[model samples]
Target: MPRFVFIGLLLLVSYSGMPQDKNVSQGRSTTSPHMAWEDLLQEHVQEDGRVDYKGFLRDKQRLDSYLETLALQPPKEQWSTQARMAYYINLYNAGTVALILENYPVNSIRDIDRPWVKKRIQVGAERLSLGDIEHKILRKMGDARIHFAINCASISCPKLPAYAFTESGIESQLNQAARGFINDPQRNTISPKQAEVSKIFKWFRSDFKAEGGSLVDYLNRFLDEPVSKGSQVKFLPYDWALNDILP
Candidate 1:
């Protein structure tokens, strides 16, 4: 065989034998590990999104183990958008629960001094507050649906999902969250002519309208009975009570 042909064959064999990056493919990273978080959610979060804090207290060690996994493996730039989105959403939620457990028997998350801005969550070498995860990272991702995914441990906040958000299912999961929150009568009383919606719409007005449309237009997408374009929208008072399952 010619020297150039032999060299080409050798190079191909060498390249094929090299270990590939398991986390990456086509410039996107694989999904983050979330089975532990999912298990915790299934065990403690109720169907209605209310939490069994006391149960969580009993399972604190499992929760901490999951959080430690996340803290050590901060998302990389190569991660798919969905992967990153799921990571932050789960991190924010798990971290919030950890925070609440740190101060169990509290009436509301707001009762904690500066609950959101406190930098207690450690991801890799960085320390981030819940506020950082929501505002600085998730919001910047430009997915309005996220507002319905991250729970604030409040009655008025969107329900905490019973399952962990996974990269493969993130899109559908977000759509379901938005639809559920928008249509749930406890959160929003909607009519063809008028609507009284959650304060979430008021607080994150820009996020809902991030895509080119009115807030009402956004609601129409999720409402079973679409509100009239000219319907009067009243923002309801937010309930800051903890979303705990009382015995």
Candidate 2:
């Protein structure tokens, strides 16, 4: 072979031997990934995002299958930021629902014994709790909008969407989630002089402020009427009642 062609071939082989990104090594599985969970949410979750917990309990099998899939297929570092966020968001929501169903007939998610840190879930090779999914992983992913994405099945939590988030539309979904949560009057008491919002905005103020400078600056992006500078802001009390639908 010509010297030039031989060098080119050698370089190609050497480059191919280098390790790939963890998530990129094997293409992320997109195979009906969250359909089961999505189907359940679409069917049983109300337009306002209230869940029909009784109906969910009756259709527990689908949730079990979805959880199994999540446990088997863990997301790796190489996945797109959008995809990683979506997966964790879905995992958090689905896992939370399963947790609630396991201890059903309860009035609220806090009824369970140490529910957030129980380490009862089998996610890939490790056991994780809702706390791990939220604090350890998703929070470190660096999106304050996530505060609105992960629901804890509580009334004060951001309303869980009727549709599941997918890599394809995660951005828009997150944007909508933020807007919906921040603008909902029942949760946010907003006015020119003051803005009292969910405890979430208080707890994760840094996250929202990071994106738009300050809490007020962020709210103006979504609020129809902007909160003026020097406005007094209060954190509303969190309602821990189950976000379940009534018969």
Candidate 3:
């Protein structure tokens, strides 16, 4: 009888000594791991739009720990209008990169469509397809400017900002997205006679117009040189490839 009691006490002590999840320790509980957008942006951004993926990978363990906490938090009560938008934007960007990494070393994102990497990933409690996030959450959500924000990890895709999403910075974020994309020589740029533009402006011209006028008119607000009347617009070929920074 005494031996049985001693064994039971030993088991209890061992269980108590087990490490607890970090999120519980911090008082913010979550199931999955994620880094807040604010913290990510502060640490990653360079003067140019280029983000430091290497730095992110360096402290990946802590970042993953935080994300686990975020996931455990209960699903939000009625995604706030602004918060929903912000979450979708973050989802699309983060999910896209995560998707790309699933099949790294591919020539283009197209190759991943074969069998394995094309499978759905659960992001923020939503099982999302790369297309669903791009079309449904982003486009169907009634926002057109997103085309300029989420990077496909390609030179042609709009530069992905180093920071995370915040409601306070939404307007400025959209403005910067617009300006940076339009100014990218590979995405959209004006030369005296010949000009190149992103398929984004072509694919969703109506989305932009819903807010006011033509995309060119919308773009002119940000460009240094005025877009002359009746200037021809041509689509630039996009490289849908993995944007891995080779070591």
Candidate 4:
């Protein structure tokens, strides 16, 4: 081989042998990556209680870029506990919205449930499907609050926030999410005499109670006019179909 070609081959071998920076090895850039998940959380909330989907879709590059910073290592000293939680939450939320758009022409997200809707999802050049992100990744790794955070594009489903999630702001974000969902009449609030609750409270009644509040206490925090104490509560039939924009 020519001398220059030989040198080039030697350099390639040397580089391959060197220890790779896991964050950079994947060819992801976290340089000046958005560190405050709160900024993303604030942007997520809109006046209408609906997330800013159009804005999020427009900045798809940022979401993809940020996710690349996620650690591929096991939950250990290499990864901050907070980072792991933020990563899982971000993936769940972002992947869900991506799934809806990938199949958006359909009237509802329910359309994606058919056996034929299978498709590959590319995040940071890694391919996984919506099902993989939700059931395989988020559900497997996250806590019960996730049921409230992961929006399925349904009106009855918890609304997707416009901003991204970060570890720093998770606690406040969760409280805000719980409050927001509880206040939305379509989701949970109703008159004192006839309260129709989200299946969320029923499904995860233990989650709220665990935090020192019964489902009633949780709902009361967000009620415009507090429901009378001791009022009977009823659960509304939750619509699991997709929350699509109507023409």
Residues 1-247 of candidate 1 have per-residue lDDT tens digits of 9999999999876543312223534323243367678788889988988999999999999999989978877777767888789889999999999999999999999999889998999988989999999999999999999999999999999999988777777787899999999999999999999999999999899998888799999999988889999889999999999999977
Runs of candidate 3 exceeding 4 Å displacement: 1-78, 114-119, 123-125, 191-195
Give the lowest summed-lDDT range of ten residues in model 2.
18-27
**Which candidate number has the best lDDT?**
1
What is the C-alpha local distance difference test score of each model?
0.88, 0.82, 0.60, 0.58
Residue 149 CA error for candidate 1 (Å)?
0.2
Give the lDDT ranking, best first.
1, 2, 3, 4
TM values, all candidates:
0.87, 0.85, 0.70, 0.62
How displaced is residue 211 in candidate 2, in Å?
2.7
TM-score of decoy 2: 0.85
By summed lDDT, the worst window of 10 consecutive residues in model 4 runs over 24-33
> How many Å off is the CA of 101 in candidate 4?
2.4
Off by more than 4 A, model 2: 1-32
Model 3 agreement with the true structure over 75-193: per-residue lDDT tens digits: 35554544455556665666555545455555666676632235364555655566776776677767677878777666567777765544445566677778777777766768644
Per-candidate RMSD, Å: 7.4, 8.0, 9.0, 8.0
State model 4's lDDT: 0.58
Clashes (backbone N, CA, C under 3 Å), per candidate, total 0, 0, 12, 5
lDDT, residue 37, candidate 4 = 37
Tell me the tens digit of each residue's lDDT in model 4 across 124-230.
44666656656666655545556667676677888776544444555656666766777776777578666778886786676656656566676676567677766
RMSD of 2: 8.0
